[model samples]
Target: MSEPETRVASPPPAASVKVLSGVWRGLGPIVYALVAGGVLLLLMGRDPIGFYATTIESGLLSQTGLEQSIIRMAPLLLMSAGLIVAFQAGLWNIGGDGQFLIAAAVVAGLGAPLVGVLPYSLALALLCVIGFVAGAAWTIVPSVLKAWYGVNEIITTLMVGFIGIRLANLLIKGPFLSDRSLVPQTDVIPFKYLLPYLPGTRIHLGIVVALAVLAAVHYMQTRTSYGLSLRMLGASPKAAAHAGLDVKRDIVTAFGLSGGLIGLAAAVEVLGVWGYVRADWNPAFGLTLFALVFLARLNVKLVIPLVGFFAVLSIGGHEAARRAGLPNDFLLLLIGLILFFMVFTEWARTKGWTAGMRLRAAGRTSQREAALDE
Candidate 1:
């Protein structure tokens, strides 16, 4: 009888190992943050189990909760899409609130009139285009400064965003203010003129729009030449310029695309939910999503689940915080902890501290075995 052939497994490829390590590095901070949050909850005499249960039950298990969570996700998903583009291009559109407000104002101010004059479908299309243009136009100054003068986009975008918010407020209160209501808001589009609901669900077409936008973004990022250039620019602008890429044009285009997407998110929000743009109404999704996009490592595939998780947290965390006798901002603290831990872990990995600790642990194990043998 022939002897059975011996078989040995080969080690994973270096690339595979690196990918696994990267995933672990990305996810470890989330675990640590969650644990820390639980500990804090316990210290505050709150039941972490109950809090989590409420979050899950209310956010996912209940139909009403799920609808609300999904509704909230629409604009957030859109914002994430914009951030992905900006981050991948090595740009930051931190003024999403401003873009959102401005877009919403434009949509709200004109939506009702358009619906009255044109077909609903055509009106919706025109409003979205207007919103996108408004958002993109708002970034003109920042984009010009960064592309032409090498001014820091962070400062310019932020300042521009502040101005946008103030401008939107002024427009809503002054130019767009509706006489129908006492509230400082633009004229409302009736529910019939709003985005249609999905079949058998209260969720509107906005979620579909968001998903489609994300799909398009992923396709553009992975399968297009423009995406490659943007990635190169983000990795090193000097190198991209050296390679004969249009550095200035790319930077300007990136800012426009980023701002436009955020503006579309705002238009969707108005068309799907609010039907009007109110003064001082800012969901402030920009900052939270900055943390989230980093958490997902700017990978479009990861953004989906992370955004869903955030949407749930935003919706259910309110009830959970209330029940736990905590403030609404408690969720922000948890997100902040996650960001802190992610930064810390990356720093530790870069310093080889994690590898050193593993080496030390292995050495201790080997030494104990040697002692036993002796």
Candidate 2:
């Protein structure tokens, strides 16, 4: 009789391995953050479980909290959409806070007056366009310098953001300051003219707009030749130039796209929720989301859940903090801890600790399966 044929097991598919790695990379920081946060709360003589339970009950379980969380996600989703594109192009548009504030100030300044002359819908559309243009315009110097002169975009973008923040304050204080009140804010758009809510819900249409932008960004990144070029540029600019890609144009385009989307986020906030811009009202979503984009691995789909989670923390954690006698800024501390662990994991990955362990585990599993078959 022929010798019995022995089956040899193969290692897990490379794609599956990658997916698992990505998932761990995404979730590991969250796990670490929770553990670290618990320790901090204990050290502070606080009840960690009680705090988390209250936060969950208030932010996610309660209907009002859920609605608020959804509403808060609107601007975050839009800003994250922009950051994805900028990050994909290997560019850092660190000035989103500035872009957001400036566009909002301009939109608030124009929205009320324009609604008086034209139809509200028409005015809303125009304001959105103006927001986009104002945001893109603010990035002109940085984009040009980065594209042509090879200047470090980090410094230029930051400096421009400072200038833009100051400019936004000036606009709210000077030109956009409302005559209706002494407060440093623009005239409010009439409630009737503001973006409408969904049927039987407090959620505004701004979330829909944010989702659409995110979908479009996903499509652009995955389905277009231009996206391939941008990916190549990010992977290695030298190789992209060797491949004859118009490197400068791509850089400028990435900046413009990122800025425009950030601007749209501001417009949506003004039109849908606030209906006016307040001086020194910078939410500074940029700093947190900057770390968050990296945490999401720059994946558009992944960003949705991450942003939702953050929104929930912001909405619910407030109530939890108040009840627990914790400072309101405690959430920021949690976020910073997540960022710290994320960087740690990244460093471990670079040192091959993570990858090596994963590979060895897979190898051993395959060997065990082969031995069983034999």
TM per candidate comes to 0.89, 0.92
Q: Give candidate 1's total backbone clashes.
A: 0
Off by over 4 Å in 2: 1-9, 13-21, 350-367
After superposing candidate 1, which stretches have Cα over 4 Å from the reference? 1-10, 13-23, 352-374
RMSD of each: 4.7, 3.2
Pull out the clashing pairs in model 1: none
Candidate 1 per-residue lDDT, tens place, 171-231, comes to 9999889998887888989999999999999999999999999999999989999999999
Point to the candidate with the largest lDDT.
Answer: 2
Best model per TM-score:
2
